[model samples]
Target: MTTFAPPAGPVTGALPLPVRRRPGFSLEGPFYTSAEIFAEDIDRVFSSQWIFAGTEAEIPRTGDYLTVTFGHQSVIVIRDGDDVRAMHNVCRHRGTRLLDETCGTVGNIVCGYHKWTYRTNGELMFAPAQPPNFDKTCFALRSVHVRSLDGLIFICLAADPPADIDTVAGLVSPYLAPHGLKNAKVAARSEIVEHGNWKLVMENNRECYHCDNHPELICTFFPTYGYEPDEIPPNLLPAYDRFLAAENDLHAKCDAAGLPYEAIEELDGRDVGFRIQRESLDGAGESFSADGSAVCRRSLGGFTDKRLGRLSMHVQPNFWSHVLSDHAVVFSVLPLTVSTTVVRTTWLVDAEAEEGIDYDLDELTTVWNHTNEQDGEIVARAQLGVSSPAYEPGPYAPSEYQVEKFCSWYIDAMNAGEPRPEPAGRSTGESG
Candidate 1:
């Protein structure tokens, strides 16, 4: 048995982190390759922020649970009776991890080390050979703060989680509600350990300047992703023209359905940074299939039109999603080490859609699966380059505005003593 222990203090003669980044530039090399900075990120940014954990579709029935482990922390997001709860995975008796599997169904959580048992609701159910005076109530599993914005689950390790999630939720729910994610079911989920810092993985996601590298994704996903109207280069003019026509058609559909299609971008200057919009896909203007047609026959949320476009949302510091008419795909980033991070992607479809009947599994997952592998390669290469001593912070192109916003949010969260502005109101416009 491999027993896990907390990490020791930093080694002597560690390089000091660059405290602040030059505005509108990439972060320094240490932010992507230093153990000390990685530890600080887990302690400050991830611990303090509201993290996107998973979806309610993950644990649908009582006793169903999913375990999320990042750095030295592990948490269980479980279904108990009618509610979903998050609790520390450590056992009260010997600090043994209660769950080993990434996800499964369990009648009771039993610590393998000492046989201590806990109920789905995290109540202490059994403790063998205990003193009669031992109070079980006092030893219930320590609960973590959890919130479900519609069907999307988020967890916070800190006791006092930021309240801006409520404000962000209010703005996005109108855009997301029509998709009816709560009623959807997990069609497929994949996890890959990318050889890169978590920050590198996120930075890679914030811009489409690298879209040419993703052949499969760029077929349906617009190549003009992060570019402003005036900033798109002549090389991408053809793609931009297609985007405009598809967007106009998408707006007509959204208006008829009363769905919010305008973007609500509030990426920085707040505790909960997010950007969401219902925009058009390329090809057939439907799902993410090779030909851009509906991957599933049944539309999620009872939409009759299969060409409803994609409702895309990106949330810092570690989540993003694309909701199509027939299906949705979600991504979560979890830091594993200074140089390795796990990216989990899940595909969701209508609950009634059967695997062989309504959708073929490979067709449903092909595009994003290829895109994720491409991204993993890009991040690993970036990590290798940044680890070299010659690497330095570089200027971000004007099209990479979201990447800059992400860096700004990260820096603000890392400064524990600094004061930040109130959560900003949602703006109805493109971020870049």
Candidate 2:
């Protein structure tokens, strides 16, 4: 039998617990800076929810595998035969970490500590010095709940994950299937560590109020996002009119292709909150380049038209993506500690598209690469300000509705006493 060490930190009694968060307002300072609340976030939010791990494109072969680590837990997402499986990355015998590398191909999972061996399917195959009565069947690697929705992978650490994901998958698959993300290949991937809590990173992404800081992105991405018709200020009305015209053109093209373009927003008031839509871009009304033209020569899913706009989707807790005609970009957030987080960005292009011939890697990734760097600086400054004793919860503007919804869902999950996993069925909850 193996014994594990306790967490390295002062006890909860030594610190001041966070105050209860108020609705329609920013979370209290402690919620972002306290060690106690950070641990609770890992338990109530990360562990209990289905997190976007990685895409199937990352593991196109049988032995391909990747390790996702967050809040002291690690999971191995691997491809075995025709199925994708997720297992806790811990040796069953002595509780040692089995795989330390971020990603690689492996015929079998072998523990470095004691040479315990397991198949790609997570079945225990060998244990060198076990008792005669020991049973290999009883020592199989523990499995984590994993599901793939149109090639995007999600994993839940809880024994009974939220069932609302099935309903979410059904509604969003039509918008995603046309892009062929499952068959796509990664063009570029990068990681940046930000000096902020995980929630701050997510909250920063929920609104475009600070988009002026992203000049590269604004060249193609309209600055009128997250605003309703009535809320459009006079300064942005002309841009709004341009957006309407481009939207009309996009709708006509989508109708001809039989693709879903209308928004389906249900940001809160359910087990799984999500929003998806295909919106028009500025300039040439295409990809993320400076002039809004196609970034790659080959189109995704064999679509001839480059003006398909972007199929954008946002999932609660931590996931968002933008699928364009020529390529797609996916973002995943992981917590490192109470005061830091890591954001991983991946760019995907057609599998047959050659890097130098069909697409320029720098041009394909320049927009988002610069945008992320700017966002990271903003989050860091926000963290610094909120750490001061003068900081207080502030009201959220109407244009920032999604941020409020995200905070509400998080607070609800934190306050939901114990796990009451929803039954397997579609949720009929009202849209937000």
TM-score of each: 0.92, 0.92
Q: Which regions of candidate 2 fall more than 4 Å away from where they truly are? A: 1-18, 417-432
Question: lDDT by residue for model 2 over 144-163, one digit each (tens)?
Answer: 99999999999998878999
lDDT over C-alpha atoms for residue 265 of model 1: 91
Model 1 has an lDDT value of 0.87
Q: Backbone clash tally for model 1?
A: 0
Model 1, 1-432: lDDT tens per residue?
111111232222222453458878888888888887787778677877988899998899999998988887899999997899999999998798889888999999999988889999899999999999989898899999998887999999887888899999899999888888998999999999999999999999999888899888877898888889999899999999999999999998788879889998999888889999888999998989777899999999899999988899999999999999999999999999999999999999999999999999999999999999999999999999999999888999987899999998887677641122223564343555
Off by over 4 Å in 1: 1-18, 417-432
Worst 10 residues of 1 by lDDT: 1-10
Candidate 1 to truth, TM = 0.92
**After aligning candidate 2 to the native by TM-score, how far in Å is the CA of 397 from where it should be?**
1.5
